[model samples]
Target: MIKPYFLTALSGLFLTQACIADVNLESVTLDNNPRVLKSIALLQSLKSPQTAMQFNAPYVHDLKNRYKVRSLFVESQNLPIVDIQLTFNAGSARDEEVATGLHGIANMAAQLMDEGTEKYTANEIARAFERVGAQLSVKAYRDMFIVKLRVLSHPKKLEPALGMLMEILNHATFKKSSINLILSNTQVGQKQIQENPSRMMNVQFYRALYGKHPYAEPISGTQRSISKITPLQLKQFSNQFLVAQNMNIAITGQLSAKEALKLSERIAGNLKQGEKAQALPEPIDKSSFDIRHIASDSSQAHVMMGHLGTSRFDSDRLALEIANQMFGGSGFNSILMQELRVKRGYTYGAYSTFSFSQVPGTFSFSYSTRQDQLLSSVQVAHQALIDFVTQPIDLNQLAETKAGMLRAFPNNYSSNANINAQLGAMGFYHQAADYLSQYPKLLEKINAQDVQNAIQKHLHPERLTLIVVNDQLDKTALETRLKQDLNPQAAQPLPTENLPNILNPPEKEVIDLPVSFPTDAPEAI
Candidate 1:
């Protein structure tokens, strides 16, 4: 016979097992199913915030000094640091003005500016800034070349940093060794660019679109152009472009209005007042479709397509901005992403963008997909654009797009550094002094009709520039699909003979370079 304690233990174990076995799993699921579906429906009906965000525009003091130096200053007492940017009209677009085939002079000048001044060596200047915990940088872009300084607000730090910047601005040596070093590095870069499928396609795209226009060349320039740049030529380019009258000042961080004004005056007084750069010629819009295919070894095809777009000052800019946000520029929710990624699963992402600059820029859409899916992806993406332009404007979606923009507008000037950038851009592009404050109101004024009209005016689906990078392309098949996409109403397939000849890009040598300098410098605006 078992002991009484052992019998009690066995009985308790049996009871526990019986209770667990009696639980009806199906009944539990049946009871919770209604609640789970209801919760999902409730979540699906939830809407984005209806109220627009209020943005308190910072006080911008716009003033010009006797030396003709324009300035936009914003006082922020949040941090002990001060940030200053000098935006000059001199950029890569003006390279040809220095001399024909000298496409990289402006870029070379920027890279060498901090290498040395007449009074200081490059290492000495670097040590001086490091000792004061200050930072100095110079960069070049398509429309502007900028020099920036960040230092403590105290006069001890600010004064020394300012002095060094002034010296460099007035008397950058552009020494022979420095010039040779930059050119040597650029030569290595040329080989790498040729190896890059995307970069090669961009070079070809600009060449095809702008044809002999100043904007046709990439800012990095070709090897032939950069190798010809000399130290004397760089100095001449600097003397002509980097002067007081050709640039504007932007100051932000801890400072009073009076102090800021004085600082601006001192900077302006140190440089010679050269004339401002003239306007860039407008890019000619093409009437026919231009398509090219580049050979690549990658398994995925990199594709880009677009036509000439609007300028920064276009009357329909706000409308186009909203439309682009809805159609492609914004991620995931954009029509292109929805069609290509969510609906078809042909690509990881599909994006479209507009480059609003001093002159008209490209309105482009680009993506990469498996090589086998290239033709279908191109056709589908093109069809989406066509539908967006030809179909009736979806007022509800437009409202959502504008709401998203208004809600996200605060990030544009959320920090002192960001505000400084905005001020610099406004001053460089000649935007109205009150442009930031009036952004929301102007954006709200746009309606569905405005967006529709702007899209039709700016986007020409019939005349597009198509670029594809893959191992090979079926030219005859792609032409047939493009003809159908361009003329859906046509009873017959359009002739493919008129399509521009495909481009065969030559292979380039690959070279790898190690990074030795700091990578934290600010990018050119």
Candidate 2:
């Protein structure tokens, strides 16, 4: 659930049409005069890593009253820095389940919250942050929203930026003039995205996997849902959910614990009590398997296949993490890619990922290829899953995946923004406070059998939701093929045209053509 940041994090950033599947390091080319490695070596290696925890800042449980305020405070006399985060529970999923996607409208409203509070206009808010050399932001997530400030540890540098943030949160005037400009452009852009087959596949996949779960709903409202959302609705939603009960405050860098406590208190003190959130009920017991395909006129089929996956709370989450990497996630070296692309040439790249959410999220395998490859590709992917679960994962494979996972984990925390995201995830998912600190250790402890067990529990390919986006693929033939390969009976196909009746309003019917494959087709990874 980590989102990409320009500076800190990159998560599952699979394809770039502009970039090809070559190991060539174009960004670090030999043609340019590069830093002479020999010269740097002669300069001598770090006697010790220049960046290390000389002073391991012990996390304070701070055991403050839950209602009054809760915040993490850290001050390093060594560096004059401060990072503060305020996270609340009014994330995008708070939108009405049936109407869907009001969360996006809420996010846009939050961005424009400071358009013109009585004291400052939108431009003034920007100018103030520019003057202070600080970053101020409000971001929306699936389960929460965040307001943050990062600045040098000086009152002069902090107050104005924080002041603007307060106005944005507490008293926002969603100016009528700005409303049309923001909403109209947003709606148009979303419309374009929904039309794309791959995007549509992903959206519909969530609806299928979660099956009426709140988390299954789209973050951005549907076309009709957004049209009905007014600024008044934004105000009302914020009022109901952005209260102190759901708020968590954290500070890092050079801020005193006392100062951190005082600041956290001040920030949360005036917010009125937010409405209580309902705990989601247990997910429905999965029944006979279902194939939820979305046939489209696109040249290639966009497939989204998966079943309910482990939660962050699952004991075997770390094991599942390792298995995911070995099975489909290790990029070129993975078994899925090795069999499907390197050996057989099914798709350019084939991969799988296990999403760890507050509740069980989707464990999905996604790949796009010529429409005809649809059935065979799913069978191949499913066979790979079966082999992974039954076989004892080689210890070397587990070790390699663990090492890779640990190495990649720190890259995610390298940016302040990225760290805050991890913090938000940890807080919201009920993950222990030490989740990040302990990530390496936990991943290291995962033995091979742990992975096999996780697979057995979660990878019931029998109940998997196999979706393919091209109508030309012979569904009947594929189902017969899958039923033969795997003992699980393949799900019967539903008439694709019927989906829009309950999901999206019906659109113009489009015909799909039979897809042709090259004798030597370049894999679509």
Candidate 3:
């Protein structure tokens, strides 16, 4: 008799075959549908697309206290739900070099804030939010730690949620048991990173790109670092960094400005006054080409390349944003995507982004492809970047990119949550009060020449550091390909042992190469 599993597999095969054979191609054809044709005709007859988007930027009411607590309120009377985003200047950037993993203390402290408070156990805190249909989220990033909450604006739901939030902020116990559990889970996560080639590549890429910089450190502490974190350290970090003056709050929802201000004051009144975090030492601008290839058993290669990018303060940021969109930011319309994926079919996706921050950030172009196609894919991507700066972008392409950005700008304030987040970012980043209002005007004034100028000032193709992670079996071929495709003087191989310690040493081996443009090549951008 046939096995049960075999019968199930046979039934699945039969169902799939039946689906394939059931289609009536003629009946489903667009030409055979009169209603579809009529709909298409009606849609085509509509007036031309709007050339200008009308956006009424939200009014932000700013308030502060003698204790230096800052808050921004955006009134959204239509929605019943309220969103509050509280941000602290404390981020991984403040992690001490000696205690390299102290940032994990901040992260762990945030995660455990709701686990238990002075007045409530973890179960009680969770149930309190659940009963009120409220949501709470805590996140730690390179630049800041955030605690966000959403709940119905009705007093019955809002009051308890606010009380619980205040309790968590003031009385997080940071129990030893919770700390140990989070640390163990984090270690498990680190071990799992070993199995992810893309994440492993990023760890090495950031290390090579931002040498000796705090940004070089993984946001998640290493195995040794995580193990080193203790309860006392976490409490100290929270006491020092999670104070009133270092925090900014943004609230948006059905509440009146008066009610929002009252809530903000309640939250801020309970905290101790503290000073803003000290500025990080500026990262050295070293553009020497570097490439790291982590040996993986996977059949495909992951590639990332670029160099230090501009800060958010740069005047040319808007222009660079548009230029990037025209080059590799737009989906299929981007030049890199069209060249590498659409034309050559080397990979399913190719994209580029400029991760601008309060400090200088990175601009990277990344793609993944079969190991054998790695060199060709890189060559194509490299050429695309060079061309993007050297050649003038078409006027129509510039128009389309600008239009797309402007059209999507309103979505940034589409909901209470979105508006709260955007307002929070503006405050955290020290953006001008009128930043959102002036954004459309800025986009409107930019032209193709402005974009090219921005490209020239911001992007440096020749100084890019290329990183490729691929199967060890292709190592020899990749080395040969690099020599032929890039300058020999600029290409220096690194020892496999020098890669970031977070990743497991390959079963085979690794290849590291430093690449630079030819000496006779055109100027930086």
What TM-score goes with each of the models? Answer: 0.83, 0.78, 0.81
Q: What C-alpha RMSD separates each model from the true structure?
A: 9.9, 12.9, 10.1
Residue lDDT tens for model 3, 248-275: 8889988887888888888788777767
**What lDDT, from 0 to 1, does candidate 2 have?**
0.63
lDDT of each: 0.80, 0.63, 0.74
* Model 2 poorest ten-residue lDDT run: 516-525
Model 1: per-residue Cα lDDT over 209-277, one tens digit each: 888887778876777888788888989999999999999999998998888988999998888888988
For residues 100-187, could you state the per-residue lDDT of candidate 2 as single tens digits?
4454664665566667666678888788889989887776655567777888778898887777777777777676777667767878
Give the Cα-based TM-score of candidate 1 against the true structure.
0.83
- How many pairs of residues collide in each model? 0, 7, 0
TM-score of 3: 0.81
Assess the local accuracy of residue 317 in candidate 3 as a C-alpha lDDT between 0 and 100: 84
Off by over 4 Å in 1: 1-53, 491-525
Return the top candidate by lDDT. 1
